[model samples]
Target: MGLRLLIIVALFLVVEIYAYQAVRTLFKPKWLLISYALISLFLLVYIVYSFMQFDRAVGQTQHTMFVMGLMLLVYLPKIVITVILLGEDVFRLGASLVNYLMYNLPKNELMPERRKFVSQLALGLAAVPFLSLLYGIFEGKYNFKVIKQTVFFPDLPDAFDGFKITQISDVHSGSFDNHEKINYAIDLINDQETDMILFTGDIVNTHATEMHPWLNTFNRIKKYKYGKFAVLGNHDYGEYVTWPSQKAKDDNFKGIKNLYGQIGFDLLLNEHRFIEKDGQKLALVGVENWGKNFKQAGDLNKAALGVNQNDFKILMSHDPSHWEYEIKEHPKNFHLTFSGHTHGMQFGIEIPGVFKWSVAEYIYKQWAGLYENKGRYVYVNRGFGYHAYPGRVGIMPEITVIELKKGSNVG
Candidate 1:
């Protein structure tokens, strides 16, 4: 552990040195440089100290969230600077080596001076993320977007063809700091007037008590006509934090489950419910938190027990990996699945349909929006709240409204 920590610190210093070169070249005044170095050092010490003080039992308090946010805000832009400067150094080195071979240059002439223009360009480019991250911390986390998607399924029941469902996932109520913003988001959900609403997990960061203050706010979600339902996500299990006792952990788990009920949602735990419309019924199967890398508590087979193989089913599973690894290939065909765990990494570039990219794509194939596999579809919500990072970048908080269409999509 000590050696690993040393290596990490060493690498961090290397990045700082490269990043500093850009600042040093851009700003010539000694006092200004000294001030920049001192500020950077202070941030480094504070971040390291706060992380060392992390309490597993307490878990995800506001102080820790603030630290996490500060760390990202301070370093992500620096990383961009470091990368650009490092690449320039590599080019300079190659040019120097060639010059030395051709002209027999002195040792002092092995490398040329850093270009002011390059440094200026690096700083200018870095400003994009720096300012963007700052805005994310203050405003983007609550920048709710109502994304509407219409999916066509041949197997969809005629009566339910035009049914609309609103999905909001990964609430992470524990991290909410502004009631006004949350209230506005809730109102946005209610405004949609969808036939049904579904919440796909991570109701709290770890402790269920984190949601105590927002029970009433969530309960104001206004009941939907076909009913509101939800399923658990990985974080809802309270497994990330250490517990004082097994009973304590169990009690928190129970409280978390009850939170859904408090908000008037039928919390489905490896269960199935039928939503009927005009004599035709559609199965809504929900499973507990199931992830390819996290827990595997969701029992899809058991959840769909009574539902027929021919019945049109909509599944609610917290992690999209459940669909990727198992649900997509299951014998009991699920026409549609709802999931939200990646949160688009709370950072990325997204432009309606023209372009979309995120770090989350490397981890989750169905990270943000809708995906299809041989007619079966999965819509992964980009989360309705922020967690560890305490903010969101390009991927804003989402309120997904999905319309069910009976016929093939028109191209």
Candidate 2:
């Protein structure tokens, strides 16, 4: 880890130096150049210091946000500059070859000096992402968007027709910095007034204590007629942090389970529950965290123990990979599944019906939105809160409302 950190720092320094040189060439004033250098140096030093203190300060929301904000303000812009500089170097190399072959020029005079216009252009282009990132930090993170979808099932009970279910995932309450913003988000969820609510894991980041500060605020979520249900996501298992002893870790897990209860959630651990209306029932099955590369404690068969294969079943699993690897292929067909572990990588462009894409797509096939395979469906929520990056980019936080219908319309 130390060696990897050194390599990252060295690479960042190289980019910083290149960016500094570009600024120096653009502005010939010594004072301006010195000022830019000092600012860059300070940010770089702070980044290193933040890395060194990460373990100790990881629980501090302000400290984490500060370090992440610095990276966005300084490092990202420099990376853009580096890309532009590298492109110019490629042009220079080509020009040098042409001069050597045609004019027999010396290596020193083969290529022209770096263009001031190029530096200016690079700076202009770099501002685009820097500004976008700033917007993400200030506005985009709290830009909660409600996505509604209607799923049609031929065998869906008539009583469940038009039954609305609100789903939110990956709260990661440990990373929250503002109470008002969170309260507003919770209010938005309640505004949906869905019949039932389903949370697909990740209430906190690492430890159970992370949810202590926001317990009351989240507990204020309006009650659903069918009640709210939740399942464990990989992060909720207390596996990321080192505990003093095995008992401490077990206690932390217990506390997390208790927190869900305090929030009025029926926390399911490889279990199934029934939501009935007018003598018609649908099975709501929830399992522990299961993923390709993450923890696989979730047992589908165990969770489906009492669930009838013929009944319309909605499975709640944290990772979408579980749906593809296990749920989809399981002998018993599931009408729908809900998941949100990817969080769309908390970044990406998603224009409904036009185009939806994110870096997370490469990692998880069903990263976001709805996907269907042989009548089995899955909807991966984009998440309700931000995490490690401290802010979202193109992808904003999500609140998903799904209404189940009894029949399909092919038109």
Each model's lDDT: 0.93, 0.89
Local distance difference test, candidate 2: 0.89
> Candidate 1, after superposition: displacement of residue 138 in Å?
0.8
Tens digit of lDDT per residue, candidate 2, span 335-378? 89999989898778877789988899999989989998888899
Listed per model in order, the count of residue pairs whose N, CA or C atoms clash below 3 Å is: 0, 0
Candidate 2: stretches off by over 4 Å: 56-61, 409-411
Model number with the top lDDT? 1
Query: What is the number of residue pairs that collide in model 2?
Result: 0
Q: Against the correct fold, how does model 1 do in TM-score?
A: 0.98
Candidate with best TM-score: 1
Positional deviation of 87 in candidate 2, in angstroms? 1.1
Alpha-carbon lDDT of model 1: 0.93
